[model samples]
Target: MNNIITIRFSALLILLVAALVTACKKGDNNALTPDLGTRVAGKYTYSELKTGGKTYPASDTNLKGTITLTRQTPTTVAIQLAIVHKATNEAFADDAAEDVDVVEAASGTIELHYNGDTIAKINGSKISIEGEDDAGTVFTLFATK
Candidate 1:
């Protein structure tokens, strides 16, 4: 009778252990969905190409003012660039809004695309964008949070 009771208790213990193991197993769906806008949305100090191997800050008289990024959608964002007069400290162009699609790659890199062309790639807190303006001149923008 004691042997029978011990056998039954061991079987129940084994079943409980198996159940707990199965319940504690991690699932493949534990990966988090990337939110690009929440990660990259902020005001950044903007810099761009000025001339041959030269760069200028956005506050420069020839360049625009600060660049602002706001989230429009899960995959899209709006850019607002301010153009100001340095001496007068007046904003001549307060709003130049442009929309671009943002993609978060599986490798944890963020890409900003305009008109189906990749304009920027962001890694960590640094962002670099390269594209051409309407005047057919190539420009590269670097920004940091």
Candidate 2:
């Protein structure tokens, strides 16, 4: 009777250990959702900029732009803008870049807002922002991861 009980207990213990080993993953668990800040923090390269009745493609000599995004809070992201879209000779001022709140619009889409305006969005590896200069010239910037 002792041998049978010991054998059953050892088998049960082995099964429990196997179950735990399989349940605990070594890295980030896909079942867990990442915070909004972490979900959108990354570097995005400019794809294009449209303004002044013209669209500047990334292939343009002076249209190259890259922005870095950092996690500020669970619902905010700080954007570092380094861009020179020569088509309109528009340069982002030092104070133009700001931290913005983010909201998950959909499963894979996150919208960025500033001063109650929707300024940008992160859709998977792509990001897009729209803004106007002092002169009221509206411009849209598109980038990708």
Candidate 3:
């Protein structure tokens, strides 16, 4: 009876130690902080737009007048485009603010994702977006505050 009790206690101690060790382990060093998103979130104007080997200036008459980046979480941001006719601005999503994931690839450099695919990147104060629209027109937008 004494031997069985000793063995059980030893097994329990080992299990507890393993669980604690795993729980105390640190995660990725490059993990983004909430403040980082806040620092990057703000209004930015369209500097340029490119598609099919043609470069054009982005204006209210041709494209989105401006874009606002709002922090949704430590790892995500909500991008809202300004509506010309709306009384108040809203998110890009039709129903809810669809958040785009923000990954800090390196210091001062960040990647943006939607639906698990990278669609944009932020370096310093500028944001460069490359993606397709609903009409299948691929475009790249460069904007800065």
Candidate 4:
């Protein structure tokens, strides 16, 4: 009788532990959502700094631009910026796609880097980027879906 009771208690203990672990995993945010790089894949209207430190908005007027992000790999993303001339209604700048590495994705924050440049830091649907132009002028970019 003593041995049977001990065996039943051990089995119940193991079952309780398993149930608690499963419940905790269901509540884990990281396990519930996709990675940051994958979550950030979408179209964004951005504001960029032009040559001579001029700011351009991605509105209908001025030099409208859009940033498209695509997931390249588990830890990499393809970024493309397309800009159009407002007057001529033609493409002004459409550069080749650049690949950026995902640095960190934790606690609802994401950071990406490209050629040692801080390409983007994202929180939720908002993103901020910092880069330097050819003329050594620092530029900041902000975007949203």
Candidate maximizing TM-score: 2
Return whichever of 2 and 4 wins on lDDT: 2
At residue 100, candidate 2 shows an lDDT of 87
Q: What is the Cα root-mean-square deviation between model 3 and the actual structure?
A: 11.4
Give TM-scores for every candidate, taking all chains together and pairing residue i with residue i: 0.60, 0.65, 0.56, 0.58
Between prediction 2 and prediction 3, the one with superior TM-score is 2
**After superposition, which runs of candidate 3 have C-alpha atoms over 4 Å from their true positions?**
1-34, 59-61, 83-96, 106-108, 133-135
Ranking by lDDT: 2, 3, 4, 1
Tell me the lDDT of candidate 4: 0.71
Per-residue accuracy of model 1 over 3-23 as CA lDDT, tens digit each = 999999999999999999989
lDDT for each of the candidates?
A: 0.70, 0.80, 0.71, 0.71
Clashing pairs in 3: none
The sequence of per-residue lDDT tens digits that candidate 4 reaches over residues 1-145 is: 9999999999999999999988874466667677656887888776654334666655623666677889887677888867567777676546545578877655767887888876678776766766564577776666777
State residue 8's C-alpha deviation in candidate 2, in Å.
7.8
**TM-score of model 4 relative to the true fold?**
0.58
Q: Which residue segments of model 4 deviate by more than 4 Å? A: 1-29, 47-61, 90-93, 105-109, 131-138
Per-residue lDDT of candidate 2, residues 10-105 (tens digit): 999999999999998698676488898888888888887788878777786466668788888888888887776557757762234456898999
- The true-versus-predicted C-alpha distance at residue 9 of model 1, in Å, is 4.0
